[model samples]
Target: MDKILLNGMAFYGYHGLFEEEKKLGQRFSVDAELKFSLKKPGKSDDMNDSIDYGDAYELVKEVMEGKPVNLLEALAETISERLFQSYSILEACRIRITKPDPPIPGHYRSVAAEIFRERNE
Candidate 1:
């Protein structure tokens, strides 16, 4: 299958377990891989035959910037659900939600959650 990749999409959101995190908010990065057959688009060179990545970015923006979820898992789930609902040709997807910084007493690059979902599921 062919794939459409969206990467390094950043947003500021108030989503965390701690009150400070919820109040101050932080930066988030999302990387998504949308899997589907691109044969039609590849051959016809028609926009209609392919998924619009701009629209996909908007959907991710809505979820990442809309509600305040306490867990990255929840955000990933919501994104997966929305993608499936929005694209009929999408066969599977992988979503990764990354927090560049958190209110934790540690030295690390970042924390992230990744999920893979198929249309049948």
Candidate 2:
């Protein structure tokens, strides 16, 4: 399958288990790989023949900043569902959500989760 990748998208949002974390908000990074058949688009070089990366980015950004979810898992799931719904040409997708410098007892650079989904064949 052909793929399009969006990486290192940053968003500032309130999402955490702690009240302080929710109030303060933090930075989150997202990466997505959208899978689809690209033959038609490749041949035609038409925007209508394939998914628009700009539109996808905006959709993801809207979902990320639109709601205040306590868990990254929920945010990731929401993104995945939105992507699937927004583009009928998308056959499969992998979404990664990352939190840099999470609040913990010890110092840590980041934590992330990857979620994968595919349209029913």
Candidate number achieving the greatest TM-score relative to the actual structure = 1
Number of the top-ranking candidate, with lDDT as the measure: 1
Candidate 2 lDDT score relative to the true structure: 0.90
TM-score for all models, in order of appearance: 0.97, 0.95
Writing each residue's lDDT as its tens digit, candidate 1 over 1-121 gives: 6899999999999999999888999999999999999899999999888889899999999999998999999999999999999999999999999998667999869999999999997
- lDDT scores for all predictions? 0.95, 0.90
The TM-score that candidate 2 achieves is 0.95
lDDT of 2 by residue, 41-110 (tens): 9999999999999999998899778768878889888998999899999999999999999987788899
Task: List the lowest-lDDT window of 10 residues for candidate 1.
Answer: 100-109
lDDT for position 19 in model 1: 94
For model 1, name the residue pairs that clash: none
